[model samples]
Target: MNELNGYDIEDLEVGMTASFSKTITEADIILFAGASGDNNAIHINEDFARTTPFGGRIAHGFLTASTISAAIANRLPGPGTIYIAQEMRFVGPVRPGDTVTARVTVKQLTRERSRAVLLTICSVGDKVVVEGEATVRTTSRARREATV
Candidate 1:
Protein backbone atom coordinates (compact mmCIF):
# COMPACT_ATOMS: atom_id res chain seq x y z
CA MET A 1 0.00 0.00 0.00
CA ASN A 2 2.86 2.35 0.64
CA GLU A 3 4.01 1.81 -2.91
CA LEU A 4 0.63 3.04 -4.07
CA ASN A 5 0.68 5.88 -1.56
CA GLY A 6 -2.43 4.81 0.33
CA TYR A 7 -3.21 3.46 3.75
CA ASP A 8 -4.15 -0.18 4.02
CA ILE A 9 -6.87 -1.11 6.50
CA GLU A 10 -4.21 -2.48 8.82
CA ASP A 11 -2.52 0.92 8.90
CA LEU A 12 -5.50 2.75 10.36
CA GLU A 13 -6.19 3.30 14.05
CA VAL A 14 -8.83 5.04 16.12
CA GLY A 15 -8.07 8.76 16.61
CA MET A 16 -5.68 9.07 13.67
CA THR A 17 -6.24 12.44 11.94
CA ALA A 18 -5.57 14.16 8.65
CA SER A 19 -6.66 17.31 6.82
CA PHE A 20 -6.90 19.13 3.50
CA SER A 21 -7.55 22.80 2.82
CA LYS A 22 -8.61 24.99 -0.08
CA THR A 23 -9.72 28.57 -0.42
CA ILE A 24 -13.13 28.80 -1.98
CA THR A 25 -12.91 31.02 -5.01
CA GLU A 26 -15.45 32.75 -7.26
CA ALA A 27 -14.45 30.45 -10.07
CA ASP A 28 -14.96 27.48 -7.79
CA ILE A 29 -18.53 28.49 -7.12
CA ILE A 30 -19.34 29.01 -10.79
CA LEU A 31 -17.53 25.86 -11.80
CA PHE A 32 -19.21 23.77 -9.15
CA ALA A 33 -22.56 25.22 -10.17
CA GLY A 34 -21.90 24.25 -13.77
CA ALA A 35 -20.39 20.87 -13.04
CA SER A 36 -23.00 19.86 -10.48
CA GLY A 37 -26.02 21.48 -12.19
CA ASP A 38 -26.88 23.39 -9.05
CA ASN A 39 -27.78 26.68 -10.69
CA ASN A 40 -29.36 28.17 -7.62
CA ALA A 41 -29.50 31.94 -7.23
CA ILE A 42 -27.71 31.91 -3.90
CA HIS A 43 -24.60 30.57 -5.52
CA ILE A 44 -24.37 32.42 -8.84
CA ASN A 45 -26.49 35.52 -8.53
CA GLU A 46 -25.20 37.97 -5.97
CA ASP A 47 -28.05 40.44 -6.20
CA PHE A 48 -30.62 37.73 -5.86
CA ALA A 49 -28.60 36.14 -3.10
CA ARG A 50 -28.49 39.44 -1.23
CA THR A 51 -32.17 39.11 -0.44
CA THR A 52 -31.78 35.63 0.96
CA PRO A 53 -31.02 34.74 4.57
CA PHE A 54 -27.33 34.35 3.76
CA GLY A 55 -27.30 38.09 2.79
CA GLY A 56 -25.16 37.46 -0.29
CA ARG A 57 -23.73 34.83 -2.51
CA ILE A 58 -22.80 31.59 -0.80
CA ALA A 59 -21.17 28.47 -2.11
CA HIS A 60 -23.25 25.36 -2.48
CA GLY A 61 -23.43 23.21 0.61
CA PHE A 62 -22.21 20.16 -1.27
CA LEU A 63 -19.29 22.20 -2.52
CA THR A 64 -18.27 22.77 1.08
CA ALA A 65 -18.87 19.13 1.82
CA SER A 66 -16.63 18.15 -1.05
CA THR A 67 -13.72 19.40 1.01
CA ILE A 68 -14.50 16.64 3.43
CA SER A 69 -14.36 14.16 0.62
CA ALA A 70 -10.97 15.55 -0.28
CA ALA A 71 -9.65 14.97 3.22
CA ILE A 72 -10.81 11.38 3.21
CA ALA A 73 -9.35 10.62 -0.20
CA ASN A 74 -6.11 12.56 -0.18
CA ARG A 75 -5.18 12.53 3.48
CA LEU A 76 -6.31 9.77 5.80
CA PRO A 77 -7.08 6.81 3.60
CA GLY A 78 -5.25 8.31 0.62
CA PRO A 79 -6.07 6.98 -2.87
CA GLY A 80 -7.55 3.53 -2.61
CA THR A 81 -10.54 4.29 -0.44
CA ILE A 82 -14.21 3.89 -1.31
CA TYR A 83 -17.06 5.65 0.36
CA ILE A 84 -19.64 3.37 1.92
CA ALA A 85 -21.68 6.19 3.46
CA GLN A 86 -21.44 9.82 4.41
CA GLU A 87 -23.71 11.99 6.57
CA MET A 88 -23.09 15.72 6.47
CA ARG A 89 -24.74 18.64 8.18
CA PHE A 90 -24.12 22.06 6.65
CA VAL A 91 -23.94 24.27 9.68
CA GLY A 92 -22.72 27.57 8.19
CA PRO A 93 -22.51 29.30 4.84
CA VAL A 94 -19.22 29.59 2.96
CA ARG A 95 -18.50 32.72 1.03
CA PRO A 96 -15.89 33.10 -1.69
CA GLY A 97 -12.27 33.59 -0.56
CA ASP A 98 -12.80 31.66 2.63
CA THR A 99 -10.02 29.21 3.36
CA VAL A 100 -11.79 26.03 4.36
CA THR A 101 -9.97 23.20 6.07
CA ALA A 102 -11.48 19.75 6.14
CA ARG A 103 -10.32 17.43 8.87
CA VAL A 104 -11.01 13.77 9.46
CA THR A 105 -10.40 11.80 12.62
CA VAL A 106 -10.67 8.06 12.91
CA LYS A 107 -13.62 7.54 15.25
CA GLN A 108 -13.63 3.75 15.26
CA LEU A 109 -13.31 0.82 12.97
CA THR A 110 -16.39 -1.25 12.29
CA ARG A 111 -16.64 -4.44 14.30
CA GLU A 112 -15.76 -6.51 11.27
CA ARG A 113 -12.53 -4.51 10.76
CA SER A 114 -13.32 -4.06 7.09
CA ARG A 115 -14.31 -0.38 7.19
CA ALA A 116 -13.25 2.81 8.93
CA VAL A 117 -15.65 5.29 10.46
CA LEU A 118 -14.33 8.82 10.63
CA LEU A 119 -15.47 12.03 12.20
CA THR A 120 -15.41 14.61 9.44
CA ILE A 121 -15.41 18.36 9.88
CA CYS A 122 -14.85 21.38 7.65
CA SER A 123 -14.20 24.81 9.06
CA VAL A 124 -13.15 28.35 8.32
CA GLY A 125 -10.78 29.66 10.97
CA ASP A 126 -12.49 28.83 14.24
CA LYS A 127 -16.02 28.52 12.88
CA VAL A 128 -17.23 25.09 11.96
CA VAL A 129 -18.98 25.15 8.59
CA VAL A 130 -19.77 21.49 8.11
CA GLU A 131 -19.67 18.41 10.30
CA GLY A 132 -20.29 14.77 9.58
CA GLU A 133 -19.27 11.15 9.69
CA ALA A 134 -17.93 9.11 6.83
CA THR A 135 -17.71 5.39 6.46
CA VAL A 136 -15.09 4.21 3.97
CA ARG A 137 -13.31 1.04 2.99
CA THR A 138 -9.63 1.06 2.23
CA THR A 139 -7.41 -1.56 0.72
CA SER A 140 -6.48 -4.33 3.12
CA ARG A 141 -2.86 -5.36 3.59
CA ALA A 142 -3.84 -8.96 3.00
CA ARG A 143 -5.60 -8.13 -0.25
CA ARG A 144 -2.68 -6.06 -1.47
CA GLU A 145 -0.20 -8.74 -0.59
CA ALA A 146 -2.29 -11.41 -2.30
CA THR A 147 -2.58 -9.32 -5.44
CA VAL A 148 1.16 -8.84 -5.51
Candidate 2:
Protein backbone atom coordinates (compact mmCIF):
# COMPACT_ATOMS: atom_id res chain seq x y z
CA MET A 1 0.00 0.00 0.00
CA ASN A 2 1.13 3.56 -0.69
CA GLU A 3 0.98 6.26 1.95
CA LEU A 4 0.19 9.89 1.36
CA ASN A 5 2.65 12.69 2.17
CA GLY A 6 0.84 15.44 4.06
CA TYR A 7 1.73 19.07 4.71
CA ASP A 8 1.45 20.95 7.97
CA ILE A 9 -1.03 23.78 8.36
CA GLU A 10 1.66 26.40 7.94
CA ASP A 11 2.80 24.87 4.69
CA LEU A 12 -0.54 25.12 2.89
CA GLU A 13 -1.07 27.66 0.14
CA VAL A 14 -3.98 28.58 -2.03
CA GLY A 15 -4.05 26.45 -5.21
CA MET A 16 -2.14 23.55 -3.71
CA THR A 17 -3.86 20.34 -4.79
CA ALA A 18 -3.80 16.66 -3.94
CA SER A 19 -5.69 13.65 -5.24
CA PHE A 20 -6.52 9.98 -4.79
CA SER A 21 -8.18 7.51 -7.16
CA LYS A 22 -9.88 4.17 -6.94
CA THR A 23 -11.91 1.96 -9.24
CA ILE A 24 -15.39 1.47 -7.94
CA THR A 25 -16.22 -2.18 -7.48
CA GLU A 26 -19.28 -4.24 -6.55
CA ALA A 27 -17.73 -5.07 -3.23
CA ASP A 28 -17.02 -1.40 -2.57
CA ILE A 29 -20.68 -0.53 -3.06
CA ILE A 30 -21.94 -3.47 -1.05
CA LEU A 31 -19.63 -2.66 1.81
CA PHE A 32 -20.54 1.00 1.72
CA ALA A 33 -24.23 0.04 1.77
CA GLY A 34 -23.69 -2.11 4.82
CA ALA A 35 -21.45 0.28 6.70
CA SER A 36 -23.54 3.36 5.97
CA GLY A 37 -26.93 1.67 6.28
CA ASP A 38 -27.85 3.23 2.93
CA ASN A 39 -29.20 0.12 1.27
CA ASN A 40 -31.22 2.03 -1.32
CA ALA A 41 -32.30 -0.10 -4.26
CA ILE A 42 -30.73 2.34 -6.66
CA HIS A 43 -27.37 1.45 -5.27
CA ILE A 44 -27.68 -2.23 -4.53
CA ASN A 45 -30.44 -3.75 -6.62
CA GLU A 46 -29.34 -3.97 -10.23
CA ASP A 47 -32.63 -5.28 -11.67
CA PHE A 48 -34.59 -2.60 -9.87
CA ALA A 49 -32.01 0.05 -10.62
CA ARG A 50 -32.12 -0.68 -14.33
CA THR A 51 -35.68 0.62 -14.32
CA THR A 52 -34.63 3.98 -12.88
CA PRO A 53 -33.49 7.15 -14.62
CA PHE A 54 -29.83 6.29 -14.14
CA GLY A 55 -30.37 3.06 -16.17
CA GLY A 56 -28.49 0.89 -13.74
CA ARG A 57 -27.37 0.63 -10.15
CA ILE A 58 -25.21 3.55 -9.05
CA ALA A 59 -22.71 3.84 -6.25
CA HIS A 60 -23.82 5.73 -3.18
CA GLY A 61 -23.26 9.45 -3.54
CA PHE A 62 -21.67 9.62 -0.13
CA LEU A 63 -19.44 6.73 -1.01
CA THR A 64 -18.13 8.81 -3.89
CA ALA A 65 -17.95 11.89 -1.69
CA SER A 66 -15.94 10.02 0.87
CA THR A 67 -13.19 9.83 -1.69
CA ILE A 68 -12.80 13.57 -1.40
CA SER A 69 -12.60 13.24 2.34
CA ALA A 70 -9.89 10.63 1.96
CA ALA A 71 -7.83 12.91 -0.24
CA ILE A 72 -8.04 15.75 2.26
CA ALA A 73 -7.24 13.62 5.27
CA ASN A 74 -4.44 11.65 3.74
CA ARG A 75 -2.84 13.82 1.12
CA LEU A 76 -3.14 17.52 1.80
CA PRO A 77 -2.95 19.01 5.28
CA GLY A 78 -3.19 15.37 6.06
CA PRO A 79 -3.20 13.16 9.13
CA GLY A 80 -3.99 15.71 11.79
CA THR A 81 -6.60 17.54 9.78
CA ILE A 82 -10.06 17.55 11.35
CA TYR A 83 -13.00 18.04 9.05
CA ILE A 84 -15.23 20.82 10.30
CA ALA A 85 -17.86 21.17 7.58
CA GLN A 86 -18.63 20.14 4.01
CA GLU A 87 -21.10 21.21 1.32
CA MET A 88 -21.42 18.84 -1.61
CA ARG A 89 -23.45 18.53 -4.80
CA PHE A 90 -23.82 15.23 -6.56
CA VAL A 91 -23.77 16.03 -10.26
CA GLY A 92 -23.39 12.54 -11.81
CA PRO A 93 -23.76 8.88 -11.03
CA VAL A 94 -20.86 6.52 -10.31
CA ARG A 95 -21.33 2.99 -11.50
CA PRO A 96 -19.35 -0.08 -10.64
CA GLY A 97 -16.04 -0.37 -12.60
CA ASP A 98 -15.78 3.37 -13.02
CA THR A 99 -12.45 4.82 -12.00
CA VAL A 100 -13.04 7.74 -9.66
CA THR A 101 -10.44 10.33 -8.81
CA ALA A 102 -10.96 12.64 -5.87
CA ARG A 103 -9.12 15.92 -5.88
CA VAL A 104 -8.86 18.71 -3.36
CA THR A 105 -7.39 22.16 -3.83
CA VAL A 106 -6.69 24.75 -1.22
CA LYS A 107 -9.01 27.70 -1.72
CA GLN A 108 -8.40 29.66 1.45
CA LEU A 109 -6.51 29.45 4.68
CA THR A 110 -6.61 31.14 8.08
CA ARG A 111 -3.24 30.84 9.65
CA GLU A 112 -4.34 32.11 13.05
CA ARG A 113 -6.97 29.40 13.36
CA SER A 114 -5.09 26.68 11.54
CA ARG A 115 -8.11 26.44 9.24
CA ALA A 116 -8.34 25.76 5.53
CA VAL A 117 -11.08 25.86 2.94
CA LEU A 118 -10.69 23.41 0.08
CA LEU A 119 -12.42 22.93 -3.23
CA THR A 120 -13.37 19.29 -3.41
CA ILE A 121 -14.15 17.44 -6.60
CA CYS A 122 -14.47 13.83 -7.71
CA SER A 123 -14.39 12.81 -11.33
CA VAL A 124 -14.57 9.73 -13.48
CA GLY A 125 -12.24 10.38 -16.36
CA ASP A 126 -13.36 13.75 -17.69
CA LYS A 127 -16.85 13.79 -16.19
CA VAL A 128 -17.40 15.20 -12.76
CA VAL A 129 -19.19 12.84 -10.40
CA VAL A 130 -19.25 15.14 -7.38
CA GLU A 131 -18.23 18.67 -6.43
CA GLY A 132 -18.03 20.39 -3.07
CA GLU A 133 -16.24 22.62 -0.60
CA ALA A 134 -14.80 21.42 2.66
CA THR A 135 -13.60 23.22 5.77
CA VAL A 136 -11.02 21.67 8.05
CA ARG A 137 -8.96 22.53 11.11
CA THR A 138 -5.36 21.47 10.71
CA THR A 139 -2.91 20.70 13.46
CA SER A 140 0.83 20.20 13.43
CA ARG A 141 2.68 17.48 15.31
CA ALA A 142 3.42 19.87 18.17
CA ARG A 143 -0.11 21.21 18.24
CA ARG A 144 -1.60 17.73 18.14
CA GLU A 145 0.54 16.59 20.99
CA ALA A 146 -0.38 19.65 23.00
CA THR A 147 -4.07 18.99 22.51
CA VAL A 148 -3.68 15.44 23.73
lDDT over C-alpha atoms for residue 28 of model 2: 97
lDDT of 1 by residue, 1-148 (tens): 4657578888888999999999999999999999999999989999999999999999999999999889988888888889999998999999999999999999988634569999999999999999999999887878757799
Per-residue CA lDDT of candidate 2, range 1-148, in tens?
Answer: 0133357676888999999998999999999999999999999998999999999999999999988888988888787678999999999999999999999999999887888999999999999989999999986545656888
Off by over 4 Å in 1: 1-5, 111-113
Question: Against the true structure, whose TM-score is highest?
Answer: 1
lDDT of each: 0.90, 0.89
TM-score, every prediction: 0.95, 0.91
- Considering only N, C-alpha and C atoms within 3 Å, which residue pairs clash in candidate 2? none
In model 2, where do residues sit more than 4 Å from their true spots? 1-5, 141-148
Q: Report the error of model 2 at residue 118, Å.
A: 0.2
